[model samples]
Target: MIAAIALAFSFLTATAQAKVLELHRGVGVHEWLNWSPVNEDGTYIWPPYRAEQEWLDSFRKGTVSKGENEFQRIRSMGFDFVRLSVDPGPLVSSEGTKRKEALAILSKAVKRITASGLRVVFDLHGVNQVPATSMKLIYDGADSEGVARYRAMVKEVAGMLVKVGTDKVAIEPYNEPAYYPCDASGTDDWQRIMEATVADIRSVSGDLTIIATGACGGGVKGLLNLKPGFDDPNIYYSFHMYEPHDFTHQRSETKGGFASGMPWPASTSTPEAVRKALEARIDAAGLSRAEKRANLAEADPLIAKYFAENWGEKQLDARFEQALGWAKTNAIPSERLFMGEFGAILMTADGRMGADDADRIRYLTAVRRSAEKAGIPWSIWEYANTYGMSVIVPKENAVPDMNMLGALGLMRQ
Candidate 1:
């Protein structure tokens, strides 16, 4: 009887000690299973143009005999985990055999990451490939049917991943939900959708961790808007960090224009100097005279606002307080909150629009350390792709920017 009692106690103790997921520093793995272009009918372009199989094969077959695969390289770079983003549109668009095959590919992909010795936060990142089955359907007040279909998809995927092992993967149902104005004035539809997302995954496995997010593009304000009344014990709240979006995303296809050479903390340089440099670049863009004038007109105010904000470590700390404060308010521990994604673009050596490498390092270090100081775990924006913010100098190569590594404290300065 004593031996049996001791065995039971051992089981209980191990159960109590086991974490749903243990993460310190992580990085996003994108453009592999995610962001694939879809057909007109919302179906995933078969044999995705992004080369999913070839990418996986690259990880399986190392450059050298008994060489390190990409995932192994990620582990060597000091990342404890990877938030593997997946474009779920294919599952939504396909049926029967096709759906099962798509899911199999995803499961194999997860196994590939673990084989290389990295944990995963399986992220369901949405894209605007098609309104019917895209990121927009769930958040923009779609019909109940659309919402139900999305919930079902999450449940199916979550169930499949947990079978691979609860310890290896967590389900993040959505990314950067765009239910704007995150306040009383905003739509509460996201509230219901977010709840259903958790409920769907919860229905799959009680032990599988769920990554919950707020509405407005997963920022701190968005997290503050959520009211998590969950009965489950395993969950991590997530929010993306790019507070001064204009600065971090500057010169990307989105918000910011072609404003390069800007510094972090804004106070590093005067607005006058920044404006002069920006105007010259705008002129050198070789647009028509009228276009140059228009570009300058568009660039001036954003520059003034960026300088006026004077973003630095202190301001970033204050911004982070909002999330930590929210956690405290909800009686949630700081350790349970996650900086799901944060990164600044790296300007290309060829002068394509991006932030300077030095500036990027400073911003990355400041944000990364601030999150650490707050006792929060963070994952940088991505592992690859020439999307401006990758740690790899060239998207195609396995080279790590030693400076970026130092900035993240992953390598010795």
Candidate 2:
């Protein structure tokens, strides 16, 4: 009876929290088991990852990995939650003993993360892979056998989550679905599959908070375009914010090093200004004369497009306002609207390409403030990564980026 009463009280608390949208400030925790770098030979490539319990035990103990408490460091920096990205590929694709072990790891991860005093946003992140992960399987279409299998997986995961309790964790059923166009032209299959997936979760855990997202790559346009046929108080709407991908994902194409230093708020920069910076960068690079000319020639068009787009705080606000309006139209509370991911790439000494520190921080401040002003809780793109978008320098025994913390409005430790 005591256990049942405690569960009831927790459910009420979770419901109340959703009623007013308890702000969940967090960062994306990736690659721990998220199918990153799917081995071409189908062998595990994630090093620094031993057994799940061993690593999770160390994480909670704060005695391993970074030589300090990592989760504790995140809390010290003022984040209260983590968007734990888990790949569903193995669990759904496995059977019998293998599947049981996979589910055990999932439970252990949630238990340890919560024990560390952090809420978990169980983000079922999927990727398009040959062996078929959640992203590809689910994206194959709403009625596909893959979707059927995934729904069953969702049901099981939801059961595990409920046992963990609703207040400490919420489930986002899918990552950026592939429904493109975000209009009548776009397929409505995602909507059906999403509704069905929610039903599957609800079948077992009715009170567990579910995060529903629009299709079209899960961006503002997608969320704005999504129409959740029904409303549940426990359900919060979610969307990703990385507008002007050129700026945030800059230099992702190649290490050619031409598109590195673009600023936030396109108005703060001009074509000539960026070209001038690139010229200096190229000169400092000491490239052969032909290479220098070739780099500049390649840079001119991208620079022109960046200026033409004219992205800035006003534009960011405009996008948020549209999402806000979508919430209002759908009768969803603004606070219930979740910004699941957003971050600007920072320049690194290695081949990683992105904005310089000053510009990157300025852009992050703009995005973070935009979400805050809209009363939307958000998680930056990631905690650590080789791609220049990390909250910490991705390395052995890594530490936080103080400037990044300040920019995200997180307390710098």
Candidate 3:
């Protein structure tokens, strides 16, 4: 009789814990239907060439099928969520037809994804992609026309989800506010903007979950400093993790400021060693000797600082400790604090596997294990694309990059 009573108590305790500790594992699907091509003058090509419209139509139809089929595959692989990155261009456009088309497409995608048993985190990523100079156009005066339009678009989008009648969709008002030191002081303009946006979203649908993030490209420190002021149980804080950026983004195609062949576990390459390689490369490039000397002088300190900092398993775990520490400080549970993005590039721009795939795998494994240990849910940077970190290799017969999937422990079988 005592054994039966103890078993019942244990069962109840486990059920309660499961309810409180549900964590979302997801991938970011980016720049598909949401991207609109623009003309040289920065104007959207409306009634996009019929060929373009046909391509878009085919893509929309294809996305729905992919959501049902391809996404199903991911779900089977143990992921249950999708962080759908969206560009607000068409949704916020002055062109009525384009706006309608954009809304319809997004609604269809969301419905299909949910129907496939995968939850969607609809993110307004386009806001951060706009150039800094033109950002004012999106965040004009306090009660600016731009602000009103943005709120309207958000409300409409939320309403569409509410109509779909599924609690699986969450709305992220903005991605990477890029506003630092958001405080009680009014000088933090972006904080005010975000608060207003959140308030507007609540007014539209109180039942919808809201995901929020902070400035400085939404780094963990930004999340630590965000003072969202009001409290709502459904609101979750998110931050991207790419600590020791030099290691994660070294020799990037877009910003290869550092020397190549920079190994992971930083101890593998000291500053002096890296400097020698940089000098050799500069020499081979046929730069003036004076230019070579100047470049080396500038790169030396950066290389030194990069290698001196965190770059291995212990250091990676310490990075998550900062995030876990922040959650504890705010009285937020680990389940509510998400590591929204983190991944290691696996290839160079020239389509060659990165010089150090083994090390990249080690780094990715470290990040994955750290997030799990800290109970911080995270989504890999992307699912498929030309980007080095994408897990899916794009081709005639697309397939998952087993090396990356294995490193991250996402293997289906």
- Which regions in candidate 3 have their CA more than 4 angstroms from the true location? 1-23, 39-41, 46-68, 95-98, 127-145, 181-186, 252-258, 272-299, 349-355, 394-397
CA shift at 156, candidate 3, in angstroms?
1.6
CA RMSD of each candidate after superposition = 4.8, 4.8, 8.5
Return the TM-score for candidate 2, rounded to 2 decimals.
0.87
Model 3 Cα lDDT, one tens digit per residue, 293-372: 66666666667787767367777777678778877877877778777788766646332224357767777788888888
- Model 1, 41-69: lDDT tens per residue? 55667754355455544433333334546
Better of 1 and 2 by lDDT: 1
When summed lDDT is taken over every stretch of 10 residues in candidate 1, the lowest stretch is 56-65
Write out the backbone clash pairs for model 1.
none
lDDT of each: 0.78, 0.77, 0.66
- Model 1 / residue 139 / CA error / Å: 3.0
Can you list the residue pairs that collide in candidate 2? 265-312, 266-311
Model 2, 279-391: lDDT tens digits are 78777767779877777777778778888878887788899999999989888778888999998878756423678888888888988888888778899888867677887
Candidate 3 clashing pairs?
Answer: none
TM-score per prediction, in order, is: 0.88, 0.87, 0.78
